[model samples]
Target: HPLFPLLALLFEKCELATQSSECPSTESFNLDIQAFVQHQDRERKPFFTEDHEVNDLMIKAIQVLRIHMLELEKVQELCKDFCNRYITCLKGKMQSENLLRSDYGGYDSDDSSSGAGSAAGLPGIPPPGMPGGRHSVPPGLIGGPPVPPYYGHPGPGPHHLS
Candidate 1:
């Protein structure tokens, strides 16, 4: 609604700049923004809000766009806000979905194997290099070879004192 006009204007300005070789003048930018608002009003179309999550996201987006248009006068803050908020929402949705699936997927809570496993399955832990999928040290003198007893000054065995 109110914010779409601003966002559409910004988009149109961006579009015009990309279409033309020369940098878009301020007048043209402003004109495009006006045209965008006019176009939306003429179409009488509502903002995209089929899903509740999408609707909420769009509201947040509009707020960010409003900041860019009115307060900060730049899109960097809007972009940052969009990315952070959207990612957090997505992560929240994913966690919620996982919880729902775990609750409904008939997971056997009594089974010990569900939680019993080596952390090697986790990400970033390099898989075992040797067989049986377990870590093994390279072949070396790990537990071999006893040092011979040293006689006096590297001479042979001790001789009888005559």
Candidate 2:
């Protein structure tokens, strides 16, 4: 009976709370509460309309969630596109290898002696003087005389390897 004003005030406050994009100012809060309370009958009014407040919040929240969900879906689609492109590129490279192998009289790709260092048949630039092992033992594999280990101690004996 006497609580009508109180219920209206609460309803007003909640309604105002939903209107502002940010927190309601103290004035706004008071005004809202007052507005809701005004709607209550003079003698008595039921609790502030829970249905209205809930409906408003639910709608706003759903909109925000939908926007976010769409953004995530877009990102997912882009990622899928990227993955597809990468797989296509890989497949193309593999196809190129297959075509090359077919042309090479069924040579297995592991036939390193036939082409591994040949960069798919492009002219290889020889490094300066020694000119790509055309002279003397290859850099890392100098097999001539047994040179002293002057470089430094050969570290502790190898562990566990046969």
Candidate 3:
């Protein structure tokens, strides 16, 4: 899963947040809709300021690719909403990394800080064949049940066009 690296970063962020008095994990983190919506609203203001145009185009492209039913006006509104949530999530993530770096003085030399940068900077790709490689197993496969292998199957994965 390409998002494995991203998920790892989020897990790390959750660990960091557990240390912050302001970010105590309530049952709300799982079941509180009003608080989540309020948090989203609070985070909407500065999230898309840097790349609004490019962000809009990317949103359109994703909508097109996913075959979402797109009414022009509604899609535009939804795009704005989606981008706000996306940017808010990203900001939270970036903030977590900053906190970790400032508090812990960054990772030790042997760890993959460089890899983290590369993975976060490049969205759908990871360093090839690494443990969290984009093409590796799904991120949530921590010991529960055996996950069946499915990558190199006979027919065609998403890469095949014809």
RMSD in order of candidates: 21.2, 16.0, 26.1
Ranking by TM-score: 2, 3, 1
Task: Say which candidate scores most in TM-score.
Answer: 2
User: Cα lDDT of all candidates, in order?
Assistant: 0.52, 0.49, 0.47
Against the true structure, candidate 2 has what lDDT? 0.49
Q: Could you give candidate 3's per-residue lDDT for residues 1-162 as a string of tens digits? A: 222232343344345444543332333223332443455578663323356676676445433422321233345566668999999999999999888766645543223445643333443345545667764665335556544447765333334455
Candidate 1, superposed: residue stretches over 4 Å from native? 1-37, 69-162
Question: Candidate 1 lDDT, tens digit per residue, 19-119?
Answer: 65344455555566567567767988555555777677756764554444343333445666788999999999999867855654423232233333223
Best by lDDT: 1
**Model 3 Cα shift for residue 126 (angstroms):** 19
TM-score, one value per model: 0.24, 0.36, 0.26
Using lDDT as the measure, what is the rank order of every candidate, best first? 1, 2, 3
Deviation from native of the Cα of residue 10 in model 1, angstroms: 3.5
Report model 1's TM-score to 2 decimal places.
Answer: 0.24
- Model 3 residue runs over 4 Å out of place are 1-70, 108-162
Backbone clash count for every predicted candidate, in the order shown: 0, 9, 0
Candidate 3 pairs with clashing backbones: none
